[model samples]
Target chain A: MKSPFIAVSKSEFILYLREPSAFFFTLVFPLLMMLLFASMWGNDPFPGEEYGYVDFSVPAFMGLVMATSFIMSLTTSMAAYREKGVLKRFRAAPATPSSILIGQLSAVFAITVAGVILLLIAGIVFYDLRFLGNFFEFVFAFLLSAGSIAALGFIPASLAPTARSGVVIANIMYFPMLFLSGAALPWFMLPDLMKKISLVFPLTHAIKLMQGVWLGGHFWDYPVHLAVLTGFVFAGLFVSVRYFRWE
Target chain B: MTDNVVTVRNLVKHYKDVKAVDGISFSVKRGEIFGIVGPNGAGKTTTIDCIAGMHRAYSGSIDVLGLDPVSDSIALKRRIGLQQQESEIPDRLRLREAMELFSSFYKKALDWKMLLEQLNLWEKKDSFYSALSGGQKKRLFVAMALIGDPEIVFLDEFTSGLDPQARISIWKLVGNLRDQGRTVVLSTHYMDEAERLCDRVAIVDHGKLAALDSPSDLIAAHGGHTRVYFDASEGFDGKSLSLLEGVESFVNRGDACTLEVNARSAIVEIVKTLDVMGQGLDSFRIEAPTLEDVFLNITGRQVRD
Candidate 1:
């Protein structure tokens, strides 16, 4: 049997595709960061390695893109829709709230997938980056990371009273996650206490998992990172479902 | 088929310290345009919200088409269409896309092409929601509600922002819905709209059911007197006018004289009294009993805002 929620998902996807701001922030901005950083510090390598900042910055930039697209964009848009009575309008019909949430999450997931693919292509062509890990393991980690971040985004979306407040709440969590989770700055550079605090954020674990898979670390080596990201997916889903509001 | 499409008994709702709906009871028959009319804080919208299953945790029973609106919401939703007081589609969603997507939620939906044509929205099918005018957005909402071809339709503040022409067009469409055997439940504070369009009206005030009847019936029952007012002139006597058989009161405001008469047609009696007294009025007009007057008589206050 065909699930009716799929129709809503398709419609949401089309609407997202038509939004120019979404395209710029999700797809274009990440590649631009990679290019700009490569120009600034591409030649400087670590003490014993030939690879420069571009090699490390490219993967961190992927985490940044996921954080922006999945966490920031999804939370802001959903909360805005709720604030504008779009969710109430849907509730007036026969559509269920869970279906609407799934529809929105699927659209965000699809956009993240497309954005990551494009980023990977640019990484390989422009910076001569390669996937040292097994292709299937990288695929699994990438999808799990996106799912975790996307789910975590709904927490702020559900709690916010209005769209503007939703953006503010998301940014409150977003900037800290970006800087501390090795997206804007590497984890090794952070002080010991900051590193401990960063571990509490899902993005920190997500970036660790992504970097592990991208740089050939075996799946068995990062059990804690995998568990933490999976925990975010579960926790986010629980809170979002419990406090979901149609209006 | 049952005659009553909606039945609300002792319905009560509260918002923190405010009692928004206080034990209002009413029933709406199938194929009738039943109106819930009241002032801004009068709970008309709250009643509709309770009936539509948009509101929950109320104290009483609300049955719509033999289904409990809150518990059987999924089944109830498919059978009823709701045009909420404040609802908007996504800003970038085009008209046709919205219609198509909403129609998919129902088992029986009207043809989008025919619905668009009927609402005069065909020409603007490709327009984004943000680009449409206010009236057009309202029409689109109406179309989305009707697309389900549901047995009952609830429209809250349906014509609040519409121009006169658009309002009339919508009235015609509502009449068409009744002709097609669909029950309509409308909430509005407009007395003229209630008087003109409702088969029966429930006048709500201060979170209670003040009165419920046909517009004319309510007017005839509680609407006290027809007031005749004219400029206070030299020949008019307030004392004599107050002594007339059906005259309730005669107030002389220096600039104007208002004679409140019990009879519906007060002009003939007023002219007769004037002739007998050898008096003439300048610029006289009779104010007949309206739904507003009925509300005023029952609540002892004007419905403001």
Candidate 2:
């Protein structure tokens, strides 16, 4: 009768540390891509220095890292465990239900923090951006953005019957959110249709909120992003918990 | 009621159209190695789960150590030790850490190091669960179930699919448990395991109780008669031995004769009568009944069916 939360935490950390490939995918890989994109897009081509291309894309790219670390990672891991009968064993263990989930959340969230730090460091050194907002807003933005996408994650987590299915469903969101949210492609340069399409995805609001906090903009708009993201976490938690099958 | 460590009254469990427990009832005495024998889906695992407070029965009452398993699970769980069907430990956790984590749950615990050594898994202490072989995993599970030094131990399919050597090792370990004064309740399909280990056994099928008694007693009660076979001399006629005392029927084929003997000392008398008839045999053998025969007689189906 051990606490499942502790089991999950210990297990996740052991898995993360034991596999070098996971480190790259979860930490080094995402950060490397963020750097690669920023390097390719940093200097605006053939123009008077309007909004810096690097400056604009940096925030969006950082948003993608958060989405991948918490949202994509959780959905994939949780779904695989469910399909493999790992979750069912958790239910019968000495650990309570709450601890199991909290353990998973903590592991994913810890990775999210590492990704966020890498993004911030790259943004400052490469883009020459100021820390316009206090530490509080930065923390809030990270939590809020993670909350929204992680909520959306449960959608795939519940539906996927196998690990492959989980990965496929996660990609369906990964491409749309990263590209349309102006994380990779500039939202301003995209066609009017693309702008409208971006509005449909929560990542757009997420990146926008991050931008607002980055620029130290109006607080009223910030709460909208936070609220929407919070709502997503709650909705996802309800669905995944109900439909999740352990083998 | 007296000296009963585990009791069930009219237990019923069903899933859609199939009844898993079938309103069965039986009890296990304190400090005894009780066994349940049946094929898969005979409600063995389901019954143990209900008794362990993991699954709620559709109806009927189950009391383990005089406490309701379903209603008072927390208190019961702390006292009881369990080895759940299939593997319950996660693949990622290491064996050394697993013992420590499980041991933390109880106020008093057996020495994890000693138990690991006893299970021959001391070297595997640092090995993660996913990497262990099936037998290693089974031993680890058995070790964990004894961590709390529980008064009543529940083991489902305790020894199945194991080599004869491994099975014997586990059987010896189980015997040691009884020597230490802990009650063990297990379900197995292997008749040899039941006959050699259990103090009492309950036979179940299609979610219904078929028979319950000590292995020898059940065999004696249901076993029809002792069968003796031998090679007869030339010109042997079964008709002449038909009138022999306690001989139900006599059959012969060329140089072989088979006598179906009845009552106490039937085999001894049959041999003596055959000797008097000058029926010198190439080989003579007594075919006594085993638990398997009794199971077949009670259920009209094989043990694994």
Candidate 3:
């Protein structure tokens, strides 16, 4: 027989695909944002930068994909499952709680990776995007950024008691992070106070690390961002495991 | 060696201010269909939850297959199957997928394809869970519970929402489980289900076990009296039935007469009495005491919420 982890992960991945809203937010929405932003700001090079606007925007959009896949999609699904008693049913089986958690995480991570690949494809096809960074460094930074956000998602997933409240909690955190973190808007365009506030959000650091690494910089270049994101990953995991309710 | 597969001692559970299961005790023998029957909020489900290790009791001890349910929960889960009262699968999940996913959770699993077919879900294997009817969904959960090929199965309100035909089929399926030497513990509010399916029935009321015995024993002890009704003849004296042997009480409603008899043999005396009275015994019917009467006798006839 197949392992519980594989069985659960496969079912969750299939369920994610069948969910129209999750598919829209994770894949379609990101590509649409890329098209809209690229058209508005034209792909011309920034004042002092060699790369065009689309080049930097593509990497930053990867942060948006992580946020949506983890915060909005993953959190809501987990809470909904709890509300419907699916989690309680799973608990009655022989599978451990860790198996369910890791299985769900793997599925959401796969979706986030797919979303990132789609953005990359769109950038290359539509705007002739450039990449001067080391492929290994970019991949490493991408994984860290996505993993941190995915881990943080469990906080809201464990706290929300119902699916509707899960959406409310996710949206409460999602919109502000989207605008301030340079995911839906550029960081340089933000006012000084807003920029200061944006630094408090994990997505801001994610965008910084992803943009830096994608533009020929090593991950070690952003020590503060790396430390902040790593802290969030551990804290999120701790809280979720501590407070998670099966029913 | 004892054949008892489950034993509960002074089991007590409370939800904040509400007492869900209060000092309930019982034992389930192996290869028998044991039932916990009660009205809504009677703690039937709560007791099952405690024994199944789904809920930790506020106080008390539970041993299933000689393992403590609270401490040996994981090990107990491996050998027991549970179909919860208010649990559901993801709406988008297909029937086949749900089966396979649950089947993989056990060390040894029955063939999911055969289970699905036996449950009449093979044709709808690809149907989304939300698309199935309520009865089908119940059957699907039952199938998932059995896919692990567990030694013991706990079904809470297993056939509550099922139609008559569906309920009968599921009852037969449960009977087969016991015949195959698996201990089956089910909770239900349907008195007929308990009387027909269970080898022994536990009557619960207000979070306490009111009575526990076989269906026949319970019926004989507390099922009240058998009622015999017959159409009344014009100018017939109703006072005559009160004098008949074994007739505990008699009521006349002008058009009909009803006699509460203490024994089944009273029916023969009733017929002879009516014949002697020249009523000709027309429109005669006998209502035997059932488990429902047993419940009403022990728990009172007041409607429960």
Question: Top DockQ: which candidate number?
Answer: 3
By lDDT, the best candidate is: 3
Candidate 2 vs candidate 3, lDDT winner: 3
Model 1: residues with Cα > 4 Å off, grouped in runs: A1-4, A40-57, B226-287
- Please report, as a residue range, the 10-residue window in candidate 3 chain A with the lowest summed lDDT: A94-103
DockQ of each: 0.50, 0.27, 0.75
Q: List the candidates ranked by lDDT, beginning with the highest.
A: 3, 1, 2
Q: What lDDT tens digits, residue by residue, belong to model 2 across residues B32-128?
A: 9999998888999888888887764469989898788867775776677878667456577788877876675566778999999999999999998
Model 3 C-alpha lDDT per residue in residues B36-108, reported as the tens digit of each score: 9999899988898888888754698888999988888888998999988898999999999999899889889
lDDT of 1 by residue, B118-161 (tens): 99999999999999998899889999989889899998989998
Interface RMSD of 2: 3.7
State the weakest 10-residue window (summed lDDT) of model 2 chain A: A89-98
TM-score of chain B for predicted candidate 3: 0.96
Q: Candidate 3 clashing pairs?
A: none
**Per-prediction TM-score, please?**
0.89, 0.86, 0.95
lDDT of 3 by residue, A1-247 (tens): 8899999999999999988888998899988998999998878787888888899888889999999988998789988998999998898888776688888888988998899899988888889899979999988888888878887888988778899999999999899999999998888899999999999999999999999988889999999999999999899888888888787
RMSD score of candidate 2 (Å): 3.6
| Model 1 lDDT, residue A85, Cα | 93
